[model samples]
Target chain A: MKHDYYPPGIKGIDGDYTAALAGNPNTGKSTVFNALTGLNQHTGNWPGKTVTQARGYYRHRGKTAVIVDLPGTYSLSANSLEEEVARDFICFAQPEVTVVMADATCLERNLNLVLQILEITPKVVVCLNLMDEAERKGLKLDVDQLADELGVPVVPTAAHIGRGIAELKDKIHSVAVSEILPRPKPVTYSQQLEEAIRQLETSLQRVYTNGISRRWIALRLLEGDHSVIEAIREYSLAEGKGAE
Target chain B: MGVDAALNLDELIEHGRELRNKLGPETEIQDEIVTSIYRRAEAIASKVAAQAGGRGRDWNKTIDDLLTSRLVGFPLMLLLLGGILWLTISGANYPSNALAALFFMLEDKLTFLFLRWQTPEWLHGLVVLGTFRCLAWVVSVMLPPMAIFFPLFTLLEDLGYLPRVAFNLDNIFKRCGAHGKQALTMAMGFGCNAAGVMAARIIDSPRERMIAILTNNFIPCNGRFPLLISMAVLFLGAGGLKYGSAIASLTVAGMVLLGIGVTFLVSYVLSSTMLKGISSSFTLELPPYRRPQVLQVLVRSVLDRTLFVLWRAVKVAAPAGALVWVLANTNIGGMSIIEHLAGYLDPAGRLIGLDGFILLAFILGLPANEIVIPTLLMSYLGAGALLELESLSAMRELLLARGWTWLTALNVMVFSVLHFPCGTTLLTIKHETGGWKWTIIAVLLTTGTAFLACLLITQVVQTLGLLF
Candidate 1:
């Protein structure tokens, strides 16, 4: 795949990185995006709050980085447009890193989106946003410990006040470049579902070498996700008759 | 798993359950694999996530629970809607009259200046009387209400109450076999029916989207509100000024509710016959409330919505004003053209519990709703040569002089609320449906519904000796 930041002819030029910014509804995903892009962004809420997507770009340490703002969805299920858009952008667009912006004031509910995204891509970062609001409610978080447990970097940010954004950018660049390793927390469904997923993932990984998480795709297949199956079929056909 | 994929999903799940049973559930390798994954994830989550203080009630969630409760939801929604309308109606009157007066005074000065310049008679009529009068009507009548309504509606939108409205009305739409998201589309209809029809594209199911498009006209568009309020004020609230505006607001809100009820009924009948399908499952997540950006909301909505509506009204109304001016001024047999037609329509109007003037108003109102009262005023006052009225109250007095009773006001209000949406909406329906058949269906449905409703209201009142 070609990267936009660096010309294709450049020698030893580090490839430009792409990151996805996702969050629960009203978790200040937009506030963070606006802060990164300096408010030179488009205006319009999602229709029926069903789906809204925005993209912003910035440079970090002389490497071009593009951040796609996925719609605020609670999970990556294909139940709503927001979820479908968010899920497709991560799996198909193949962003180098996916940042799940968690509401610090309501972390438990926000974690659902984070866990769901982590199940797809190993390159994940948890941004605990709205720290001010959390503090106002007398809550506290251990960012490093959270990072350690999830095998990913966690940053506390108050995007409205422009706090912790520099750290967020630096962490993203580092993670995307593989300078830091990510240890993702794996989730489980029912026993019967897990047995099916294990067999499905082994088959998928052996069949398509460069595709997204085989386990997540298997779970989607079980859930009757036609879009995912169509995606896999297309990928297989593109790889040629010999590859499968 | 690959073998199971070849089998039907139902049979596969059944086999999986049998395999689990034979492997003795807890001791089974499948159970251990799934449990270990969950256990590892939960352990990590537990480590970094500490109990933040003692567990206490979340006030935000509590308030949301009450606000979105099924039992209290509908009533609370109506109360808020009625309150906003009451505020707009009561607050907008003085400004609307003042604006009308100011515009008319400017028109008169322009007329004097044109005469001083010795402009040609037809040129003067077309420019000053026709073009300027239409712009003035669009500004004076449409501006104040839109200026007031859009901000209130945007405020509700920003406060995140609209999603809850969709949630609350899900059952009613489910019963109709239409998408629950139709509630959101109906809210958009209150702003503009064409926009509402456009918004219905969000419903994934074509059947439900069509149902939404077909029924969108039942909700009174912003164009019709001015007419509804005017009639309600003249008839229902005639007893006192403040009370009149309040009652007028309630009356318009009641009319809106009737439109919603009719939308559901029509959707139910259509789903059962023309478009049959089970309603798709939908889940609405309520976004957390935020403090509205007052300045941005005001500026954006005023610039975006008010201007958009006014621009359309002006474009359509100018040609209409010229046509109406010609109709009123061209004399035949000592009666101008409009009088001849109004006289012709009077008997049919009377049988339908309306007068010729009211019928003529609806006929002329087809181009744009902003001019219905102005056209009726021109007819009754013999002001065929002149273009604009000075005030709403003067117009009210003219109708009063022409034997407008409370019964007349009630019939007019009902008809205005139920009549076909404006020309733009019809064209939009045609565009969205992509067929003339559905467009014709929409036109027939709304106009037929309006005629039937007014017919019943008039008949019941007359037969009961309650109206004379």
Candidate 2:
């Protein structure tokens, strides 16, 4: 598919697709980014190495895809700078596909970020990185089962060794082109909080007509995230004027 | 466009605030969200992943268990440290002498060329003996050990063992109300203090970062390695000890441990007094050990680190050497400037178990610690600039001629370990702290500690000598 896709709100982008790489710290997120984009961002063996976002592009199947490597963060709670940056990009940048990378050796801890990303975007492919390390640790992951659980494509990869990268790129291309639709399972909260979120989401939907997720916006609002509230107000004002 | 929409948005924000207030504290909300996410992740992972036969996991656990165990960890650390020092000292000697011979031969050729051109005597002394000799001394002395030590240290870093060092020392730092990452920075200081100050950026807390920056100087940088190694070899390696290399290595390792001790003591004092704050908690992830990339380690350590530090030292040493030459040759009130200055400082230096020339060398070596021994040699030999002895025993004899004893050698090593950081480190501290205030505090704190420590040891030794 030769579909032209820019990041949702950013103008003047010529790429056919935009993909974001997200993961926890030291999960070889940059390795996957470099592998896909063919750019060498220095990878270190410690946490908090990538404090800022790095962007590059790669061509696959006659399509140019721009990939942005978001800062490695544990969650989307907006506590630290990396978290704020990661959350903002996922919420506002609106890339066509987001590949949430996770370490296969420590899947449980890494899946935390994967679940949070799924709550934000349905166009996500969980890249199970460090498969070599996982196998060495005697941990075997059923990729099909994981994909079924998350309702998204799961690609096993050893990014440093350049294994499974072709399949990962193909998955990204398909997901970006809407060839594979992902219906992610939303994180369930308490009943009272769920009621509050539903109420807020209805109010948000009334004001917002863009493709942004009202439920996610409502959860952020209930979490007292001022940045999300400000973003919605700006988006509503900008888009609502033309609609009205 | 409507006033009603803006009012509704304000109401929405107010509603959010209300909901948050109703849901207890923000931390509790965060904790609950994290708990739910973690719970889901655990469930999904358990469902999708299975554990089987033992492999790298078992060996990694067994190794980490021994490496980080309480009884074995400290001794292993010391042994590794001592072994690295032994390797560096023994490996560097032949190469250092060879380089010195080669450079000094070049110096002779330059002198012959100067004479053939009929250059003035004073000008020849200033150019060839002053700047050239100083640069030569620094390169021959510093390049070998750094070339040896940095790659070895980088190998450890690449093996992912440095974080385990931090892990082993974390509880001690926590007890001192300092960030555990300070141990990592201090480990970096073993290579260079300026880099150590920069490494303090890894620490998240401003209070702890400052504490780390301030106390990092207590550890000797690579610039001081040559001097420490030389002193260790001369003093401890004397009397033809059977394990001369081992004895020297132990001495160097003991100095390093002493430096670490002073780092902790100063960190404790700073945290409890000036930079007081609650110790922030962080997760130190011990990464899985990967086989080190030998080619990458060699390139990074040799080019990025070893050469970079050698270049900086040469830059500072050249100008400082010329200045020392001028001071040693210039006479005022019937004595060379250096001699006058040393005589003036001798009493105070003696109070701290150091002599005037040693104190003078330290003062002149402020630009770079690598030049300290060279400066002392120049002043003591009554030469216009730095000179080298043919062997370590000959160098010991020269010190003995100046009334040097084992106590003097011990005190000099201690003083070198505890003294103020060199010029680059001071500037780095200023830049990192974004002000001169903390840099000056760092200088005063380290220099004061060095003096106090030397004074205490000197007096105690003297009193014990009288009793004996």
Candidate 3:
């Protein structure tokens, strides 16, 4: 019942801020990771190119940050291991900044994951990657408008060509240090589901005291996420033992 | 406090379950959530994005139509595969011969040095004749084709054609109750089976992934290519064909197609019986094509794939060469150990249309497939060391002198395609599956199929001969 979702091989350092790179598959997520960390992770032009979570470290503004590249998933549904892994890391490890990368060419499909991530955490940055490909395909994105709409910093990057990387790093640093506060717009569910989530959240507040949103936990529990239920039970027991 | 906390948590979970039941099935709730998210994404995208032109989009659509169309997809895939094989075989011949000459020259110099220094005969034989010769053969035979083939394969992958291949074959795989992504792994197997096994991790379902790993060995890898091509040229092309090399290329390509056929057949059988499960659906995105970076492809393929596989083959082949030499030289009872073992196995080998030397070579070539032909040639000549014939004609003459017919060549090619995977691949299977149980199953499955296929083919050919 231990909450040990971070893959065993990767351990975050004491002073290093942790960032998780989340994206749809083939949105150049790995490319951005390699560019930021200077690590030679293999980048392939295919979906599900990264099946495992790879961790690398990068230094910015005299502070070293550990970056974990999560597997690409379209949604946080427990339909596959990738979705589960990406969901668990974001909810449990709670990396200081979660960079949600999206493809500029197909912004709508990519935005689904961004909306799901925003529901879980406010410390999110939308990286619109493949701007070059998007332009070539005759598509244009208003970066500032996207940022304003989502209530988070949106950096338009062509990670393959190393454009907008500096701005991405700066945003990640500010968010990690609590200098930039992002209040993400939460997705509104059905009124009936919302009523159920509120009731469950109030009942669970007595036992759950982590900084994670109780409403999100309530939603996941209502959705029958067995892992989330188990995580909550473990956290409650640990807290009780500490008090005893 | 702990007991109270545990009770409260259980109560909350129970409450959550009751709520979930009230909401109906998990899928319906999931559908609602996904639809809402998609709707929101659409709204936001509409508000922020605009299209300016359609040139690149049109270009990709046209290419995808030609490549993935039902009528032309299969034929185009085969044509591209055959073209690559033809190029690899034709381009590799000159460099392979040149490399062989250069390595043999070095071998002669090493022999002279040993003689000049009063080195012992057995020592000279072990070092120069046994280990060095085998290493030289593996390098010369493997390097050029890999050097040419890996880049070409990487170029296609870079051009994003591989996904289209998966797209073309997805329905067929679905019918076989396997994942469509298995096509990508099978393509990787053409380069190396171990890599193909590793690539199976991309498949989401555990059941389908196992199917991919188990059947990957049916595809002929780079190591088996030299043997398959040589046999095809010597046997199939020699049958009064004017366009010999072209016919040989077609024959080799046919062998590849057969491997793919066997893969699907095995996948179907396994899915129906041992690894029974419904194939899970996945969204395979066909990315837009991009012009491959020629310099990057060359550098990455040579460094990452070609060198890596060649290094592994050489590491195993060196010790295997020494072992083969010892077996060929040390007499058991007036006959060397190699001859004695082959004699004992000759009956079974003949029953399957292969001779004892061919079977012995396969057994000894467990560590690496590239050494199979060299081992067979050395054993047949009783050379007590690995040897390489100068040309394809010389190899054909040697085999013909030793009672090889077209039947032998055909059986050898068939057996090589269907046999147990090499040692590295078996180890990889074990590692990927996380147990020895699946690895043993993979071995028994492939080896059993190989034996059965060879037996059936041999019987059919003999029956036809009697009829004629």
Candidate 4:
């Protein structure tokens, strides 16, 4: 009751605002966290190196924000602990600005998680890391066009070498304070699935009083993801108990 | 849509559960959701990203092909490991001797100061000889090799070569009926067995995870490396400079190879019998190798690994040193406590090609494998008076004075590689496996394998010697 599923006992993610970092593995997510927090969280070129979440704090534009680095997960399917941890923090904790870090060299694979997170929340900032690597490889992403396409802020960064960091913080600061509101145009499913989600969202919204997006919850319910439903159920019970 | 304030938590769960069924009885909603998400991602990517020459990944594929190729892979892995071990051994020699000389010189100064203060013999002996000597040796012997080895190892890890190792070993793991991810955990075990056991969570199958946990100790961790290196240098490398260093590295490499071989053997045996399972295939994506952060890696690893490991060894060895002094100095009916204990265990230890002091050290080093040689040296300090302790030759002299043969050194190396996991690792196993039963089985499996291996080796060697 006292907490919203931030995966309890995670220290230092309580500030004026909170941002959660999510991405596919080896996408420079932790490097971005270090570049912001100035903390040397281990960054190795190994998947699952970060088996658990790490939390850090940063101050930008006179606003001190707590940044939680969720474990690198491929999807919100919750097939593994990494996925479950990333999903719960995003769905329940609902940080103000969610930075979906993506690899600039292979934007397509990284965008899978970015799109998934967009469905769950509106304020998404796509931190396109490894821009230098991308450039050396003769590849580049049109950052503004990416922003326009995804309906969010896309900040190009060679985060390891500290380029584009200032702009990233500026975007994060504005988004957290709602100056740059991200009305994310998330994925639309088939007609039958959309109809099912609409029917579920109508009934589910009444039971869910939190800031959680109703359509996202409906999609998850239809998909039979037990962890998401179980966590939301418990959160609602606590809310109901606290209300009474 | 907004009139459900009266509904309670129980109703919410019941509604959600029943609602899952209302989605037309599994009409591929999950598949559709996933497909649409990926499709959306692809759509955005097409619009925003400019295509590269598309040959960026070709270099990575070329390297991965050579590294994992059946013809060149295993040999290259062996050479790299052997070269690293060679470098660690060669690089460690001067620094170890210098530190040993420095610490022993300080020990003499501390001894003079203790005598000037008119401290009693037991007090001076405990402080200067037992505790200080162990701390000095642990630092001098343990720090340099780790300082060199770990940075290089971290360089490889950072350069994205470790996963390629796992990739190369996948087929062997598959043949063993264990998950290929076991290779990843086994690679982790080279750093620390406790950490390696924890890394087993990546393996999805419970049976394969158990196999990884039980067999992890076979890959000698950081704690065992110093012992293996010192033994190899002194005993196997007695032939002088050129051949000597090469042989030393080869012996250490050989021991490492044997440890790995035993890992696969034990994994295979377990998977076929007690813990049966099909080896599930996995997607092993090799990350593109990046240029390693050389200066940063050196500073980070030396501080994080070298000094940290040295600090731990000092903390543990100091008290263990005092305990060893007490055991070796205290008299019971004219025989020291260590002598009595060693005497009781002497026959068993002898049959396994080790002395009782060595066996006692292994037992005492249960908390950590790093402390075994420190405790043994401390025991020697009590037993052998006025003997110097510095350098490989001096260490060899000390061992030679205490009646150690080449066979003793070889068998000690053998036993060190195969013994039970350290206490911290056992505790980690308990946490990972969630019970005492598997932990107990782990102990028996490792120690049982060790005792049998050493016994067979010693018996065979000695019989061969007599006939020759």
lDDT to native, each model: 0.76, 0.84, 0.84, 0.84
How many pairs collide in each candidate, listed in order?
A: 1, 0, 0, 0
Clashing residue pairs in candidate 1 are A151-A183
lDDT of 3 by residue, A1-244 (tens): 1225444534334436888899998899989999898962332221233455677777899998888788888887756778877876787678899999999988988998999889889999899999988887888779899998899999999998899999999999999999999988877779877788888888887765356777777777787776776765676676566667
Task: Provide per-model DockQ scores.
Answer: 0.26, 0.47, 0.60, 0.45
TM-score of chain B alone in model 3: 0.91
Q: For residues B153-233, what per-residue lDDT tens digits would candidate 3 score against the true structure?
A: 999999999999999989989889999999999988988899999999889888999999999999999889878877887
Candidate 3 CAPRI category:
medium
Chain B alone vs. reference chain B, TM-score for every model: 0.86, 0.92, 0.91, 0.90
User: Candidate 1, what DockQ?
Assistant: 0.26
Instruction: Give the TM-score comparing model 4 with the true structure, all chains together.
Output: 0.85
For every model shown, what is its TM-score relative to the native structure? 0.85, 0.88, 0.90, 0.85
- Model 3, position A215, has a per-residue lDDT of 75
- Top TM-score: which candidate number? 3
Between candidates 2 and 3, the lDDT winner: 3
Chain A only: TM-score per candidate: 0.84, 0.85, 0.87, 0.89
lDDT tens digits, residue span A114-213, model 2 = 9988988899999999999888778888999999999999999999999999999999999999999999987788887777787777676545424668
